[model samples]
Target chain A: MITPELLLQELQTAFSKHKYGAEPGELYAPIGYIMSLGGKRFRPLLTLLSASIYTDEWQSALRPAMAVEVFHNFTLMHDDIMDNAPLRRGEPTVHEKWNANTAILSGDVMLIRAYDLLLGIRPELMGKVLARFNQTAAEVCEGQQLDMNFEKRWDVTEAEYLNMIRLKTSVLLGFALELGGLLTGADEASLQLLYAAGENMGMGFQLKDDLLDVFGDPAKFGKQVGGDIISNKKTFLLIEALSRAEGTYRTDLEYWINAADFDKNEKVQAVTKIYEALDIRTFTEQKIREYFEKGLNALEGLPAPDGRKIPLWQFVHQLVERDK
Target chain B: MITPELLLQELQTAFSKHKYGAEPGELYAPIGYIMSLGGKRFRPLLTLLSASIYTDEWQSALRPAMAVEVFHNFTLMHDDIMDNAPLRRGEPTVHEKWNANTAILSGDVMLIRAYDLLLGIRPELMGKVLARFNQTAAEVCEGQQLDMNFEKRWDVTEAEYLNMIRLKTSVLLGFALELGGLLTGADEASLQLLYAAGENMGMGFQLKDDLLDVFGDPAKFGKQVGGDIISNKKTFLLIEALSRAEGTYRTDLEYWINAADFDKNEKVQAVTKIYEALDIRTFTEQKIREYFEKGLNALEGLPAPDGRKIPLWQFVHQLVERDK
Candidate 1:
């Protein structure tokens, strides 16, 4: 079996060697820059790892894996515009670096290019793969729309939040694994298990991100802790805190949420106090663990031998276990 | 042989009956609105016409024909956002009726949905068709970028202007025809001829539009006769006039172009005089005729019976022969 590190190295090398496109420098430059910004490449890595579980030719999955990465960055490029975010991966976002119009057009091309990459699949599988991709792509857009909708309303339920994230974030992960399995000639049952493993792990991954944004070491997290709290973001923790906080606890949380002007540090600290009282940190951790275990159970049930599955398990653990 | 009118009617009914999507009213409403706005359905009609040239079952091409239409509107939605265009087909553009973010997200889904329509193609032809669609799609974006670039440039040449429109407007028409031929199992040489006919006719169609914008009778034109001149849009007449005008005419043309503020009608009159002085109308008309004839010749070269070819011939002539 290829080691996880080798697989990632292979992925990075192939990615660096590939070019998006050039010309009409305005439309193509931002696409190249965003691809070069280099997020975790976690989606592509999952794609390769999933393929490895079925066959030794993991290297063959590289281009389709890059398709997932490109599609993800395309969403980020557009989402940054919608969210009015100025930064990504500690760098200026595409819209910030170029402009919104350039980002919009470039993002559109990236999506077309993603479909182009999938065209490399064997003809018999191409239509099936594209059908699934279209479904996933539409779901991601729906997820984004729902997330934006939540911004105006204060009464969003936890189920709604989970569903929103599942559509926006998790389904692509599911498709990534499913695509890998499809490419490797895995049976239908194995493909379902692969998709389930990725989906559950993606949920854990997102929940862990929510936890880290509040409780992680600021230096280790690579961003300001409590940003979601500061921005009044409707993350899982905030949804739970709102539903469970009562009396003075509810009053305090509401006060911070409604505050238009205050010392940022003071508000974060006060909210952290309420979260501590509610035991929200431990609660979130427990939920994250549950999702991780669920994903692991799915991985365990796959028909592949344990030796072939170990790399995938290690990778999932690495994603979820990032510095509590 | 199906007449052009019958082919167009069939395309319209199939398109009207085919829905984009529903739910998340914000995300889908604008899509439905734009699709329903009723531009001539020209692209899809050309697709059906091209299919009928080679086979009697042109009805089989309807879904993929709608794919071309959907992709065309998807570009218009995002381009309206980029151009800040307020209207399309005399109705509020998607971005104007809904917000830009709505337009962006919905436009993204429209593209994915276009690919979904293509999934109905036979498996053997799916990859080739998609590959061509990607190329055509990328060129269209490139064309849009070039057009935007021209806005800031005072020295755009006529050649550059034609190339830009060819990329922006002609290739999709080419692909629309080419896709029909591909669907009907037309041989590769005939597909090229079909593509050429649509492309050349598209060039003529755009040049005719440029011509009518300056020279068409105001009551019949359906738009301001000299809107291009008032806006100093770099159309064929202006580009040719710039290259050929001399002395007082050159100075006058430059003054109007550089004028910060002026009466719209006065500017239009001044530029129209300069275009007439250079005989640009005759020049533009000649170019339009050349392209139309070139397209007709390609259509004539098709191995199909002359009876089968006449409808396509008449359609190309109608598109380029518009007086309004």
Candidate 2:
């Protein structure tokens, strides 16, 4: 059985070989530049791995796998412009490196490129794949909108936050796995199980992200620990604290939330203290575990689970348990 | 025969009937709102009208026609966000009225809905229609990127600007008309001619916009006339003046181009004088008429030399001759 790392390397190799348009340097150049800024290549790797469990020739899923990566990058390019983010993966974002308008236009073309890639799927399965992709894309946009909307509202509930992240982050994971199953001619029942597993695991991953934002080691995380707290971002911890805090605790939380200026350590310490008092960390950890368990159960329920399924499950477990 | 007004009315009627999802109030509300803020509706109307040229039941083309309109609006919503423009058709732009993130998400859904409307197209023709639509969509993005690139360059040529506008604006118009022909099962030759006609006419239309931006009466033109002049945007006239101006005129043009703040009217007047001295208006008029003639020739070149072609040509002529 191939390790996830080996699968990822194979996908990356395939991606690097796919040629976009040759001319129109303004358009294709940025695409190549962004794709070159390698992350884990997790999405496409998962796609291939999911296909591998059902079929020996997972390379048949490569085009669809590329679709996922292209779509993912398209969103990132546009999101960076909207967020006014200067860097991505510690490198200048497309907008910052090129320009906002170029980023916008390039991102738009990347979306078309995704559809072009999807067109390579078997004609018999094209409609279902496109329908699924359409839903996933719209959900991603909705999730982004909700994330932005949450910024202006002080009353965002934990459930609402979870739903937003689920939409924004989890649906693609679901689609990635489901697309692989579809490509492998898996039955609808098994496809559903895979989708549910991906969604549950995705939620667990996001919750872990929130946990890491507050409690992660800065060196390992490659960013400031408690960065979300510093930004007054409404994460799971803050939402829980906001929902469960008492009079003085609520006031203290609100003070930190509304404060114009304060010592960074003091603010982080105060929020951490409040979160501990409310038992928010423990509550979040329990929720994360629950989601992971649910995801694993769903994976186990897949009809005629292959021997390689254990490694896939282990891959997700490792993701959920990561400190960073 | 339906007048352009009746065609536009039909489009609005069809557009209004769409019951977008459960969050219909907020999600789909913007579609109606923007559609209500009426522009010429020329693109979709042309689509419907072109379809009518072959079949009397142009009503059958309503959904695809609406797709064109919806797709147009989707581009506008995102473009407004990118341009940071505050107005559309003399009303507050979506981003200005709501926020950037909402506009982005709403725009994303609008694109999805465009596809949804397109799915109503006959299954046999769906692939062809989507392929054309996808190609046009990507070209539009490419054109927009080129336009943005032009902003930073001091040496953008007139030809480059024309090509940019051709891609950004004209290709969609060509696709719009060609889509009409495609839906009606017109011969490929006729469809190609229709596309060429629309492309030529569209170039003429955009060149007229550049002309009107400076030369048209302020009230008649809707927006502030010469707004482009004040911004020193590299319009056809400015590019011509920059290329042709000798000694003092060249120096003065460069000075105005570099000027930080000056009397708006004076600057407009000075640039207008330079353009007049170069006979840039006449030059642009000749170019516009050349394209219009080419468009007419293409329309005449259509497989069927039916009398109805005269009215269609007349409709295009009327559009070109409009003051506003």
List, residue by residue over B1-324, the lDDT tens digit for candidate 2.
Answer: 666667777777766676544442445556667777877778888888788788878877888877787888888887887778899999999888877756766776777767667655665676677788888887887777777778778788888989999988999999998999999899999999999999999999999999999999887988878899899887878888888999989999998889998999899999889899889999999999999898889887887657656546656878878877
lDDT value for candidate 1? 0.88
Expressed as tens digits, the lDDT of each residue in A12-84 for candidate 1 is 8887788777878888888889988888888989999889988888867788888888899899999999999
Each candidate's interface RMSD (Å, one decimal) is 0.8, 2.7
CAPRI rating of model 1: high
Task: Tell me the DockQ of each model, to 2 decimals.
Answer: 0.86, 0.35
Native contacts, share recovered per candidate: 0.85, 0.29
Q: What is the TM-score of chain A, computed separately for every candidate?
A: 0.97, 0.97
Q: Is the docking of candidate 2 incorrect, acceptable, medium or high quality?
A: acceptable
Off by over 4 Å in 2: A1-3, A19-28, A53-57, A217-220, A258-261, A305-314, B1-5, B19-32, B53-60, B217-219, B251-270, B305-314
Which regions of candidate 1 are displaced past 4 Å?
Answer: none
Residue-level lDDT tens digits of model 2 in A1-324: 667777887888888898765546888888998999987777777788788888888889988888898989888987888788999999999989988766866777787788777765665676677778888887887787778778778789988999999988998988888888999899999899889988998899899899888877888998888878998988988888988998999999999998998899899989998998889889999999999898888888888656768657657767767888
Local distance difference test, per candidate? 0.88, 0.82
C-alpha lDDT of candidate 2 relative to the true structure = 0.82
Steric collisions counted per model: 0, 0
